[model samples]
Target: MADRMRKPAEETKADLDKLFLEKSRVKETMSDVLAKLTANRPKDALQFIADYFQSTFEQSKRLDKCYRCIMMTHHSRPVYQQNIASAFDILNQSKLGKGLYGVTGSIFDELITLILQGTPESHIKKMTDRLSRRRYEAVTYHVFHYAVTILAVYKDYLRVAEDLFELLDVNSSGQVDKVYADLLLTQLSTTFDHFKKDCHSGIQAGISLSPDALHTTVSKVSRNATGKEFIDCKHFLELSADVYLSLLQPPD
Candidate 1:
């Protein structure tokens, strides 16, 4: 039976067609999940199957999330910075075309309303005013650069912590599993190195995490979270940042 199946399988059976219709990867996600299940070798596969969807993974593939992510990722690049300057140029012209000059508070507010969040409106107004000299506008590539710099990097710990949470929460479930706690440590390390390389942050690369340190943090959070059996990203990052930031060092 195995020999016969091998002869016809190529023609009769098919692998998962790579799903790429308008960024919807439901088919691909299921394929990966099923592949992991086989590797996991759960004793009661049926019960595992029953708990699969119920346990986690509802996607938060929002359009705004995508746009924000793209903008954030590329903001440090020269060409992207140029494009932003050009966009500011266009917006400035649009204001002038309306018999106004410089990027206005109202215009700046409208442009950023969709992409920027967790920032105070008052702070935003002050930013616009600062760039516009307490009055009229938002460009020159330098002015745009300064303003974009703020937009890109000015958030405090609490506000930008959501980005860390979203980074760790692979399924956008707002939490991560205890089983993958070690995995998150790996991800955190890689993310640090990636950011250092990508943003030229001068953090010194090749950062590594001590597994015991991460495990202790995970255990502490799991205790505090109580019965959730999962560590929410907020608690994990907040606590781990304290423990691990000191530990991070350039490879000697």
Candidate 2:
């Protein structure tokens, strides 16, 4: 029976066509979600986003594709502006903000690596053209916030923080200097506060970092690096991925 029932060319073609259609449907659904996310009525968008994340199964497999779609859409002018504004507003305020917040660190890492790997200046210029100054800053803040929050809960936060300080130094300076040190502390503190407020309150207080402890760590790191020499981007990205994955770690 097996020998007599060999698969035909037509069957292979039909299977390929079906697979293509499935992928196309997924892309369209993602596009719709992206649109809703960046649109003016962010509350409705947030609900849809939360629902999508909740309903989706095997999220690990699709995460990269979803992240790429978001980045591509965010690079376009109209969608870029909308996302910048909505990201700041919705992501900074609502509980459903987790949907937007959870995915941005890796996306930011990807963007920074891609930019730095090439002519960074030209790529930065193009980014500036696509996004307004405020929006650009907001997006930057979100990325840092996401990265720091994830790292703070884990054992390697200091290492990753120091690496970031060096990368932003840009001058290949041995030390973190005052400005960048302050910037790192600020990002860490702000994101820590956010988690304390949003993630560690009411019924969801199962997983959180100690605000005072986080602040102390930030202060110590910042002060130690004030005059001390520091050592680094893809390495930081790998560290960022580690931190991001840690967020998904199940509570004991």
- Per-model TM-score, in order, reads 0.35, 0.23
> Each prediction's Cα RMSD?
21.5, 17.7
User: Residue pairs in steric clash, candidate 1?
Assistant: 102-137, 103-137, 103-138
**How much is the lDDT of residue 132 in candidate 1?**
40
> Tens digit of lDDT per residue, candidate 2, span 1-252?
874676798678878998897744567568756875777456676687877656443333344343343345423245654544443343333122444433333234433333233333433343323322332133455444343233224323444455556655667754545544554555544554555457544223212234444445555566455444332333333333333343342222
Where is model 2 more than 4 Å wrong at Cα? Answer: 1-170, 173-223, 226-229, 249-252
User: What lDDT tens digits, residue by residue, belong to model 1 across residues 1-252?
Assistant: 765667454634433233243125466447755975898888988786666544323112222333344364456466776566556654544323235545554344444444445555554554444434322344354655555544554343234344545654658887866545445555455655565456564243322233454456555555444434677765665543433343333222
Q: What local lDDT does model 1 show for residue 221?
A: 59
In order, the Cα lDDT scores of the candidates are 0.49, 0.44
Give candidate 2's TM-score: 0.23
Candidate 1 regions exceeding 4 Å error are: 1-73, 96-100, 117-141, 153-199, 202-252
